[model samples]
Target: MTMSVTPKKAIRVVVWGENRHEQINEVVRGIYPDGMHATIAGGITELLGDDVTVTTRVLDDPEHGMTEELLAETDVLLWWGHTAHEEVTDEVVDRIQKHVLEGMGIIVLHSGHHSKIFRRLMGTTCSLRWRNDGSDRELVWTVSPRHPIAEGVPQPLIIPGQEMYGELFDIPDPDELIFISSFTGGEVFRSGITYRRGYGKVFYFSPGDEVYPVYHHPGVQRVIANGVKWAYSERERESYLVTPMYLPGGFDRPVLGSPDGLVDYYTRELIEPRENAG
Candidate 1:
């Protein structure tokens, strides 16, 4: 028998930016006058169109613009933080972590590898070698062409100028490695990688440095949009993914907790049941 599936509505996306450099550095400001988060959000909208609904948030916003209500409505979140990772409070990081565990997708971009949320999920220092002389060229080689995040992405996509991120990246092995980037300095790095945390997906793409107009590159934009799409979780949002107790012959239903007494799997009843236990 064929099972019918419901069509998905538009993907809800939140692009979170540090918005620090643009406010202080002239070059970064020139590259992204409206803040990198806005540019990133625009790119997702431009590529996905009606398939996605994108919104921008920044570090300066109240609660860093990542309230519980906002995260509940967000299917996927894109984080771009650079100089202010610590400013992101532990409370907000805790919330984001919980949401991710509950099936909210996240795309951590560039310097966001050092962000609190990414590191918390990664359980590593998430450190890597890097240079920012603005003289390096980046060629993002698509190592996994068939990967969903590599869709429409050109082979060896070139960026005229970028900061170099070298290897020895300290993190757990990625679930998938989609792109490897080679810099002019003869350094190579895993530029595009993915991971799974509980029911949520994570994508880390290290191309868009704020000093360079990498976000304006069509190839990079396409890759980011594809990452957003691939990272989205179709499962209904949950408080968390919990281990449920199931009774034999009642496999269709799952009991979240057995507060009163132990459940008898064979008999499908409670052992030493409490007076008010249902």
Candidate 2:
């Protein structure tokens, strides 16, 4: 007998960006007239349709595009940052981290690997060697050939003319590494990696080049769409493993406590600090 594969649930995504390059650089403006975040949201909207909702936000917004209220309502957040990573406020980062710990999915693109959320989740320096000459030809090798993220792609597909980001990227080992990038400049990068901190899943995909139309490519969009589906859980289940107080109220106490100890709500599992802030 064969079992049926369940249809994937739609993941709500927030297409977020620094939104500066479009205004400051003519090339970027020409490539994505509506802004990169809008373009990404367009791709996701086209792919997932009514099932998935795609919304856009920018750094210059009232809360730098990430507010506690907005994050509480977001399921997945796609971050695109280049020159304005430092401009993102610490408070916004905290809100995002809290949501992730509770079970949100995060996708970081290109230059966003250095963003605060990525660094905090990975718990590392999050540093990498890079070059912006814009001549690098990246061969995106789908190493985990059997992984869900590579489900429909040909192995070692090429995305010409990308920025080179070289490792040893100072990040905690990813829970899974979906793709590796080989550049024309003879540099190799662990370009696509995934990690889970608390109940959330995080993915980092490196394809968009600052001056190139990489994001507009259909293949890139398909891969990211696939990733979003892969990152979603079978059902959005609560993260906590087990708790004593969860037992039915007014239960008569066992005469000898049937092997289980008394429950203490005040004494609970401590979460790892979302940031290494002093």
Candidate 3:
């Protein structure tokens, strides 16, 4: 038997950030002068370069930095939000979910677990526990080592200092549970998860603490870049069926092809609230 391999496809990724932390937190500012999105996008550019096209978007921008046109062009969208998830309009969230359903990849980072789109897509409360004492040592455990999203991951990579997000993550089962995290204080979490929604892939990674320099970590950056490439799908899936045309005026129905309820004017395809409903 022969095995099959997929050809390399150029991934188009947009790293969307709220940009509030960089402005409000000196530590965050010191880590990413250009903003978290820029830092993350820089890593993607450095890692994938010609293999991927990375862009940055922020919440303050018009259309909240994600217009329908831009969403359509983006093969994968990376989200990082803190202190401003509420600022993201539901319209944009709807567009994002719709695009995801149409096969666009999505990578939700850190606090983005509570992002409107993430909650909507997952249909869960998307809540978690956390502590801001800055005593948490994030030891991210590598679970799905063979998954492309975990391609360059090192087991239990340590973030010496950061905010601890403890969890009984409220969400549905993911297609693949990639990386889990066990904090130094004895809290366990499903820190990374991958799922398929509609025709697209989705991943949630908990990192990039607002007060820590997580984006600078080589392992974290590698995972983000790999995730961008992994989540994207090459082909779009069409679900709606087109109805058949009516026969010419009064043409005699063929005996074998009688119009006896066999050929209807409309075809019934399962219609979801969102056209690209996953």
TM-score per prediction, in order, is 0.90, 0.82, 0.82
lDDT against the true structure, each candidate: 0.90, 0.78, 0.82
Task: State in Å the error of residue 122, model 3.
Answer: 0.6
**Candidates' RMSD to native:** 4.1, 8.3, 8.3
TM-score, prediction 3:
0.82
How would you encode candidate 2's per-residue C-alpha lDDT over 1-278 as one tens digit per residue? Answer: 99999886566789898889999899999999999998888888887787788789999999887887887677888899988788888888888887887788888898888898788777877898888786778888987888878877656767877778887788888789879988877889998888887788898998897688888887788777877776665445343434333334636421111124443333433322324212
Candidate 3 lDDT (Cα, 0 to 1): 0.82
Model 2 root-mean-square deviation: 8.3
Clashing pairs in 2: none
Q: Model 3, stretches more than 4 Å misplaced?
A: 1-9, 237-278
- The CA-based lDDT of model 1 is what? 0.90
- Tens digits of per-residue lDDT for model 1 on 249-268? 86876554367765554344
lDDT, candidate 2, equals 0.78
Worst 10 residues of 3 by lDDT: 253-262
> Candidate 3 on 9-97: residue-level lDDT in tens?
67888999999888988877888899989989999999988888888989999998899899888899999987888989999998888
